[model samples]
Target: MSTARILIKHGDVRYRLLKVEAASDGSLICLLDKDPQPLKGGIRVETGKLIAEADLEKPVPYGRFSIHTTGEIHRYSGGQRKDTIHIEPLHQLTKAHAVGYFSIPTPERLDTYDASKHTADVVETLEIPTEVSERLTFLLEIGPKALKVATYGIGLSYELYTLVSRSAAARLPEELAASFVEAAALTVFDSRQIQKDEAELRFYQKIYGQGSFVFRENGGAYVALTSVPMARAPTMRVEFDGSELSIETIPFDAQNKPTHKVRFWIRDKGGRNKQHDLREHIRSVVFDARL
Candidate 1:
């Protein structure tokens, strides 16, 4: 039941796992690791992109870890308290089989609303990643639960983008090239007071779809938009509140090949009174595709 014991089980030979929880808004203030290193800094023992029945036989490196993930979207089994999982060995012990058992408490509440028509809660699930041990305890306070959580939702894509840049590519994996590309495509606006207005969220999402690259409103008081690829460029100038902040982007070509240099720049006045500063923001511009 303790996070430490559960994490050790997370890496068991026959597949260990635990049920971790996350907040709806996605801010994880709880620390999972006693030593608390970023998950991105840890190894990415590539849990294959998708799980197929064929993956069990796949020979992942012995020393390297595999981050196998599984999910369930069930109706809480009509008052069933637990779910059973099976674990089997690979390599020399291919034919041998064993089962590791674990269970999670059903959600305290359940509802039947909207689109899916599935119960709102009461269902729970687990995802297991292979590792030396579950050293990251804080994760339980911040990660997705197995069944109800979705792996492909928009929010997760952004979080993973942060993970890849700050931890995975920049640190252990040294996936510099790929990280650059991801960083270029992923943009995180460091806004102090973000607006949560649905109309505003939809407005910005539309601008992003238009490919205008960058959009700001309310006198730069809000983050209206950013481009997927343009966000990741290496060198660019951002003019905000009469101050210029230079941010770097990863260099990637149209063909996905590495390039010598790439840049993006932003210049928008909050209002007519600030229009005079726009020229100053555009001191110079250069884009060499050949590089």
Candidate 2:
């Protein structure tokens, strides 16, 4: 028994092994096995080409066409083997389902096979939305783990800070408002830096105080509290160089100089670990009820 294969060109090119039921007068009808019900359609000769599956090693010659073992359909002219038909395989087909037809590429000899070049062609033919397709391609290449970390871990932290900042701007204590906003912004920045190093899911905690608010790092494992005078809020400056954590508080006085500066060095096994610790400490003081 011979298997039936159909070569189709309908805007997009597709070569698939379909169960062909009948072929006559340049028109063919096939029964789709994958569909729940049989699909019947008249495929004109101009739109499709049908070939019977046979022993590839034994070339089958029918009139002017010959199916060779190399999976090439060769044309005979004046009893001489003429041109070899070249079939391009669909690329990026796995990213999306082939709408009208099942996406399957015919086997070709190693020397003549190159599917990498047709990636753009396949993506264009699918007519998928550009943004959606790009995101899908990125997700496919980067894997789900990285996507989850980006969406949930880093992305969530940013959202939380934005929400807190907005709320703090309206209801936070007047003296601690500046400290709260600054801490929130710095926490968001540091969260992005150390999110990759963090192995477990930990959220920021809020601690309220009279003239200050503490953003507890990674659930209170590390703490850096930002404090100002009860009379007024001072400008706060924070710097972390992977090993040392520094915070300088400058009051709005006549000299306008830093009134208090505190620094802590976090020595660890590696620079990355030290940076991670410092980032956590900075992050811990970003959220508080007073803000």
lDDT per residue (tens digit) for residues 147-175 in model 2: 23222111111111110001111222333
- Model 1's alpha-carbon lDDT is 0.23
Best by TM-score: 1
Q: State each candidate's clash count.
A: 11, 5
Name the regions of candidate 1 deviating beyond 4 angstroms. Answer: 1-237, 242-244, 257-291
Q: Per-residue lDDT of 238-290 in model 1, one digit per residue for the tens?
A: 44444543323434466653221232234333322322323333333343332
By summed lDDT, the worst window of 10 consecutive residues in model 2 runs over 159-168
Candidate 1 C-alpha error for residue 243, in Å: 3.8
Whole-model lDDT for model 2 versus the true structure? 0.23
* Model 2 per-residue lDDT at 158: 18
